[model samples]
Target: MTAIVVAGGGLAGAAAAAALARAGRDVTVLERDAAPAHKICGEFLSVEAQASLAAIGFDAAVLGGHRISRLRLVRDDAAVSVGLPFEGLGITRRRLDAALLDHAASCGAVVRRGVAIRGVDCSDGLRLDLAGEAPIRPDMLLLATGKHDLRGVRRQAAEPEALVGFKMYFQLNPAARQALAGHIDLILFDDGYAGLQMVEDGMANLSLLVDRARLQRVGGTWTALLADLVKRNTLLADRLIGSVPLLEQPLTIFRVPYGFVHRPTANDPDRIYRLGDQAGVIPSFTGDGMAIALHSATRAANAIIAGHTASAYHRALRRDISGQIRRAAALYRLARMPLAQRALFGVAGTFPSLLRLAAQYTRVPPRARSALY
Candidate 1:
C-alpha cells in the first residue's frame, strides 16, 4: 500500500496518522510548526474526547491535566452552576498535541514537522506541494489544518465570517484558583462569551468568542477590548483581579465560521478526507470541538482501512455529527440574544437537568455505535 499523507499535524491529523500506522499502514504527517505550541482553542476535553484519547493510549491525568466536573454560567449578577454530566479535563493543546505527535512517531508514522502544504494537485493522484520542497504524491490525503485552509482545497465559500476569537493564559491567584477549581466557567456579555478553565501547569485558559463588529466598536485592540468587556462583566473582572498573563500577547483568530459543516461535492476526485475544523466548526461555547476532531480522525481511519470511498466517509460523518452541530448552533444564537440568555439562565437555574440534557445532546456519540466506526 502507498503511504497515506496527512496535511497539518494537529489533533486530527496526528491522531489519524497514529491509528493508521498502528494498523500497519505507512503514514506520513506534514506539520507547519516545527515544535508543539499553543493554538487558539478552548482546551476543554469532553468525556468523548477523553475516551478517544484513552483509546489511543495517552492519559490526560498523567499529562497534568486538571479535572473539571462542573459548568458555571455567569451573566451580570445572575449565575447558574450545575455538575457536568460527565468528567472533563482541561489541558493545553501544546502538551496534548506534542504527546499525540510523539505517539504517532512511536507507532512508526513518519512525522514531518516544519513542513507546510502549499497546495494539492489531484489530477493524477494526490500531489502535495510542500514549502521549499519537491512535491510528494501519496495514495490518500487527510486535511486537518484546524482553522486553516490549504491553497487548492479550501472549503466552499458561504456567508461572510464575522466571529473573532481571542485566547490568553493567565496565572490566577490562590483565591481565584480555589473558586474555579474543578469547574469551567462560561461568562456571557453583550455579543460574546468567554470560556475559562484551569488547564495543566496551574494556569487558567480564557478563550473568548465575539462578534467582529462588536469587538471593533469597543476598541479594536485586545487590551482595550478586554478592558471594555471587563467593565460590564463583573464575574470576569473579579476573576482577573490579581491574575497576570502568561504571554506577552494574546492569541487571536479572525473570521471564525462558527457553524460551518462541509458536505461532499460531486466534482471531487482526490482521495482526500477532511477532518476537525476542516469538516465542521461548532460553536466554541459548546466545548466539544476537540472531541469532534479526535473522533472524526478515528472514524476516518476506520473507513480508509475498510476501503471506503472518501465521499462515503464524509457523508457518514455528516450524518453522525450534524445533529450536535445544529443543536449547538441554535444554542449559540440563543445565548447571544440578551433576553434569551436571561431566560435560559432562569430555566437552567430552575431545572438544572436541562443544562445536562443540552450537554448530552452536543456530545459526539459513543464510538461503538458510530456509523463510521
Candidate 2:
C-alpha cells in the first residue's frame, strides 16, 4: 500500500501532494487528465490567493498573470467601478495547475497522469480502484476531486437550483480589451451572472453561471443562451460584440454546489481527508474559489502531518471559512434578485468602499491570512 494517495490532480490535489512529499511522506497523485487544460473558472486570483501560493513556493506573477486592480459591476446600463483593496491576478487555471503539479513532482511526489479512479471503497481502509492500473490500498486517501464526485464515495448533495458553469476564451477586439484593462467585469442578469477579464496571451475569459431552469429555457445550448442574454443585457452585448470566441464550445460543469462546505460526518472514513472543492465551495461571485482550494489543501496537509484525524481537520476547516461561506451565500442570493441588485448598486454607487468590504468579508478571515504558511 502507498503511504498516501491523492485523488484528482487539480489545485487541491497537487498542493496537498507537494506539501506531503516535501515533508518526506510517500505521496502519489492520480490525475484523470493527461495534461493541465482549461478549467471552468473565473480565473481571478485574489490577493489572499497570491499570498498562499507564494508561501508554498509558487509564484503566479512569474507565470505571467495579468494585472487586475479594479472591479466593474454592471446591471443593464447601471455600472459601478471601484478600486480593489489589493491588486489581484488574472491567469488561466491551465497554467496554475501545471505549475503546481510540477512543483509537487519536484518535491518528490509521484504524479500519475491519465489515470482516473473508478471508485473509492473505504470499507476496511481506503482503497481506490483505478481505470487501468491495479487498485491502490493506501494508508490514507485525500479526496480533492474539485466539484466532481467519485463512485462509491459520495459527497453531500448540492443546494436546490445549483449553478452550472461555462467558460469560453475570446480574443477581444482592441477597443474591448482596452476597455476591460485592469478591471474584472461582473455583469449580472436575472437568474445568472458572468465574469469577464483579461488573462495571459492577450486573451479574455468569459465565464458564466446560470441555474437549470434558465438553461432549459434556452434549449440547453450555451450559444442560444448567450444570444438571448445579448438581446436583453446591453452591457454584456456591448462587451462581446466584436470579441472572437476561441473555443468551439465553452468548457462546462453542471450542478456546481456554490455554497457547499464539508463537515465531519459520522459515516466519513477516519483516514480519509477531504481537500479543496471536497472541503468547501465559496460563491464564484466572491472570487475566492482558487484561494480557498490552495489554502485548504495546505491546511489539511498540516493536519495530517501533525497526526490529526480527518474529523479534526474538517472541523478546523469549517471553523476557518464557514462564516465567510454563509455570508457569501447570502450576498449571492441577494444579487440574483432584481430589487436587491438595484438597492446594492445604489448603495455601492454611493459608497464604493462597500464593494471592497463585500470582497473582504467573503474570504478567509483576515486574522488567519498571515498564518497560512
Candidate 3:
C-alpha cells in the first residue's frame, strides 16, 4: 500500500502532496484531466493566497499573474472604488494549477495525470479504483476535488440553495485593459454578481455567480445569459462590449453550494481527509477560496503526519473558517438585493475602512511560521 493517495490535482490536493512529499512521506496524486485547464472561479487570488503560495515554494509572479491593488464595486451608474487592504493577483487556473502540480512532482510526489478516480472502497483502509488499473489501497486518502464530487465518497452539505458560476477568458482591447489594470471590478445586479480583472498575458477573466433561477430565466444559454446581463448592468456593458472570447464556449458549473460547511458525524468514513471545497465553500466574492484550499492542505498534512484522525481534521477545519464563511455568506446575501447593494456601495464609499475590515476578516488566519514549514 502507498503511504498516501490524493484525489484531484487542483490547488488543495497539489499543495497537500507537495507538503507531505517534502516531509519525506510517500504521496501520489490522481488527476482526471489529461492537461491543466480553466475552472469556474473568480480567479482573484487574495493577499492571503499569495502568502500561502510562497509558503509552498510557488510564486504567483513566476506564473505570470497580474498584480491587483484596488477593488471596484459597481451597480448601475453608481460605483465605489477602494484600495485593497493588501496586494492581490489576477491569475488563470490553467497557469496556477500547472505550476503547483509540477512543483508537487519536483517534491517527489508521484503525480499520475489522466487518471480518474472512479470510486473508493473504504471497507478496509482506502482502495481507489482507477479507470484502467487494478484497485490500490493506500494508507490514507485526501479528497480535494474542488467542487466536483467523486463517487462513493461524495460530500454532503446542509445548505439547500446553490448558485451556478460561469467563467470565461477574454482578450480585452487597450481601453478596457487600461480601465481594468491593477483592479478587480465587481458588478452587482438582480440576484447575481459579476467579477472582471486582468490576468496573465493582459487577458481578462470574467466570472459570474448568479441564482440558478435567474440564469434559467435568461434562456439557460451562456451567451444569452451574458447578453442579458450586459443589458442589465451598465458597467459590464461598458467593459466587455468589444471583448473577444478566447474559447468557443465559456466554462460553466452548476449547483455551487456557496455556504457549505462539512461536519463529520459518528458514521463518517475513516482515513479520508477532505480538503478545499470538499471541506467548506466560502462565498466566491470573498476571493479566499484558493487561500482556504492551500491553508487546509498544509494544516491537514501536518495534522495527519502528526497522528491525527480525519474526523479531527474536519472539525478543526470547520472551526477555523466558521467566522469567515458566515461573514461571506451574509455579504453574498446583501449583494443579491439591489437596494442593499446600493446601500453597501454608499457605505463603502463613505467609510473606506469598512472595506478594509471586511477584507481582513474574510482572510483565513495564517498558520504559525514554524508549523507551516
Candidate 2 has an lDDT of 0.87
Determine which window of 10 residues in candidate 3 has minimal summed lDDT: 364-373
The residue-by-residue lDDT of candidate 3 on 185-227, one tens digit each, is 9888888888999999988999988888888899978888988
Give the candidate order by descending lDDT.
2, 1, 3
lDDT at 154, model 3: 85
lDDT of 1: 0.87
Q: Which stretches of candidate 2 lie over 4 Å from their true place?
A: 160-162
Q: What's the TM for model 2?
A: 0.96
Clash count per candidate: 0, 0, 0
Hey, what RMSD does candidate 1 come out at?
A: 1.4
lDDT of the candidates, in the order given: 0.87, 0.87, 0.85
Candidate 2 vs candidate 3: the TM-score winner is: 2
For each candidate in turn, give its C-alpha RMSD to the true structure in angstroms. 1.4, 1.5, 1.8
Worst 10 residues of 2 by lDDT: 154-163
